[model samples]
Target: MSRQASRRARSIALFLVVTMVASCGTLPRSGPNKREIFAGSVLQEGDAFVVSVNPRVTAATAVVPALGFSSVFRDAGELGADTIRPGDTLGLIIYENVEDGLLTSTGASASLIDEVQVDSSGFIFIPYAGRLRAADSTPEQLRRLITRRLDEQTPDPQVVVRRLAGDGATVSIVGGAGAQGVYPIERPTRTLSAMIAAAGGFSIAPEIALVTVTRGNRSETAYLSDLYKNPHMDIALRNGDRIFIEEDTRAFTVLGATGTQNRLEFETETLSAIEALAQVGGLNANVANPTGVFVFRNEPEEIARAVMGRDDLIGTQRLVYVLDLTRPNGMFDARDFVIRDGDTVYVTEAPIVGWNRSVAAIFGSLGQVTAAGSAVGIN
Candidate 1:
């Protein structure tokens, strides 16, 4: 080939290289590469805080959403099985020494009063005892009070008070439990865990089962497994308390150059960053940049302040944490780092990938150029 023609071909190749290099951003990619991400660092105009993963950062951001009962749940005392309350039914059997006593039938020394309902005011009345406070008193205590009131009208009165199944003290179990129903707060089921067991336990796996106890205006939640590990979570249940058991809905999104991009639910009570990667089959080995794994999250003000070592940031701050698995302690840092809900895990492509594609494109274009030059007999 002549020198001028060779120079023309060389210039074409150089132009192709420059064009390819300049258009790297237009290349098909899952997300931004490491350099592009670093370009948006906190020092830049973007408000997002970009931080490198390390032991200190991992420790500061290793928090999992707290799942357990609060002080209001733990401090409340348990209700007694026999404590009388409104809406409860009392079964009273009165015995008199003389036949045909005040409350007895003709020629009978005993009388049975079944289904004696306590009024909303917590008072119950007998033919001779009149109105007596029945709520807040145990069966034996109510029996004594009834006898004291009846003794003035009958001689040697004997009384027995039996608390029957009623709606006075009960809890409602709903959602992912083996059986969903309203259960009474009886002797065997006075606490939260016991009531759950009485409802045939949770339907989901214990590791992912979340139990929420709602009493009045407040509610608290804890993992079913946590209830077994921490006794304090097995709080005493109150009447009208509602218990809901459900699978953990926490999940993080995996995107970018990972093996697969999908939203994955938490597999355990606490999921680590490494574990979350493993769930999606780890990073794509071919194009993934081992030093460019990042977790994007909107951290609360308190955690954001602690992570960036700044006090001025407010509200939920966007944070992007970079992880370099090529470093000595990178694997450990990932293991210690916690993956929270609604987080996005991204793995950037290697820098060489873009260069490889550009080179391939240039060679293909060069073949086309040579074919046209030979057709015109330039060589």
Candidate 2:
């Protein structure tokens, strides 16, 4: 061959060899791979946040109280009964008797008045009387005030005031509860358990459920676990109070070549990839491929555009991080990778996965064809 032609051919051959080597997919031996690893540092048992609950106030303590009370009585004596504020409907019953010369005559009267709507001025209007301050008075207190006013107008006036409608009373139960609804606190008696029973009891698993109380804009979260651990956590329901049962918000699923394949739930706010793997009872000893672990995440494109400065291809923006588990240094990188909600982790087996499937298919086909030929020969 000519020298120039030989040189060109050699260069082409070298390029082809390099391309083939690259296509063969060699394992990373040195330097950090751009892919993120899913591993977390081992946290000791005491390392987690532990709030020491007093036994006196825990659910164990509250159990006696819960058992002592009936559902009916608990529903009746709740917080709404004790306080009467403005904007309450009052039912008035008045009895009057008049005596004539020979025979005595008596008359009974009952009336459902329009709501004694307490004005912003903190005054309520009665039928015969003008506006009276009733902003902080209970139903019984309001009754005495109305009676005094009537007595001033006449002698021995009989008056009874019963609160027909309480101040705007509603309790919101959310999260893990059997029913999530806004229940009206219509009467004086409404207990926490009663409210829960009214809306439906705790339906979620105790470990994963959380109850939050929000009054006005103030919010407080209570672990349902704590409710069992401490009785004091259960508070009386107040007007405009909200009860929220939060679902198991922290959880991840591990699948493929794992000892156990199932969705794992966590109570902690954050979980690393390694922690998620551990929760799934660790990887399968025989089938797990140490070098081919992958975490598939549906990342929003906006995040990539901001952080990685990558091209925002509308549909293709989602990223898949393929991690190598064989390297010891990869463990630290995996620790840094935080598990997000609905994240799926797939630990793949070796390339023999495809070969095994192919072999199984070939055997099955051979058996079927052999059977068909025998039937044809018989025919």
Candidate 3:
């Protein structure tokens, strides 16, 4: 080939390489590289507070939303099944020593009152005893009061009061329980766990099952397994309490150069950063940068103070935690780092990947240039 043709071809190839290198930033990439991420950090006058993963950082951000019962639930003592309420039915039997007494008939010394319904005012009426307050009194207490009232006319009157199951204290169990119904607060099912067992345990896996109890104006939620582990969570249930058992809906999003890019549900009650990565099939071996793995989250003021070692922050702070698995303790820090709900785990592409893509573009353009020069009889 002539010198002029060779020089022209060399110039064309050099220009193609320069163009490709200049436009390398526009190459298709999963996300920003490590340098780009650091460039847009708070240290670089950016809004996001970029932190490197360490033991202290892991511990500071290890806070998870806890579930438990308050004093209203834990301190509220169990209700007695025998305590007469406004809606209870009392079975009464009146016996007199004389054959033809006030309450008894001829030859019959006992008179049976099959059903005595207590009114909404908590009063029950007998034939000769008149209206009497039956609520707030036990069966034995009601028996003594009735005997005293009937003893005025009948000789040696004996009164027997039995409390039968009626519209008394009850709780409604629903959502993810083996059986959903309203169960009375009996002696065996007065507490929270006992009532759950009465309705037939949780229908979902205990690991992800959540039980929420709503009493009056307040409600609290706790993991089903936590009730067994923490004694205080198994509180005493109250009347009109509503229980709902459901699966945990907390999840995190995975993106960039990982094995998969999707939203994943928490597999356990508490999830770690490493386990979250594994759930998405881990980092992509071909293109992932081991030093550029990042978890993006919005931390509250308290957590932001602990993590940034500063307290001047206000409102929710945007945070980006960089995890360098190449470090000796990086894997350990990741194992201890808590992956909270709504977190975004992103893996940047390797540095070499961009250069490789640029090089491939330049060479492919050079090959076409070389073939065109040969067709024009320049080579």
lDDT of each: 0.88, 0.57, 0.88
Give the TM-score of each candidate.
Answer: 0.91, 0.49, 0.93
Best by TM-score: 3
Error of model 1, residue 259, in angstroms: 1.1
lDDT tens digits by residue: candidate 1, 79-168:
887788888999999999887799888988889999999888899988889999999999999999999999999898999999886578
Candidate 2 Cα outliers beyond 4 Å, as residue runs: 1-25, 28-80, 95-123, 165-167, 174-176, 186-189, 252-257, 260-264, 267-281, 287-379
RMSD of each: 2.4, 14.2, 2.1
In model 3, the clashing pairs are none
lDDT of candidate 2 over 158-266, digit per residue (tens) = 6676766664566777777887877777543365656777777888777666667766666666566665565555456776777777665666777777777788777
- Model 3, 1-379: lDDT tens per residue? 8888788876877697778667765666777788988998988999999999999999898888778787778888777778887777789889899877887778998989877888878999998888999988899999999999888877789988898774677899999998999988888998889999999998898999999999888999988888899887799977789999999999999999999999998889999989999998899999999998899999999999999999798899999999999999989988999999999999999989988987787777787777887798777
Model 1 segments more than 4 A misplaced: 1-25, 371-379
Q: Candidate 1 has what TM-score? A: 0.91
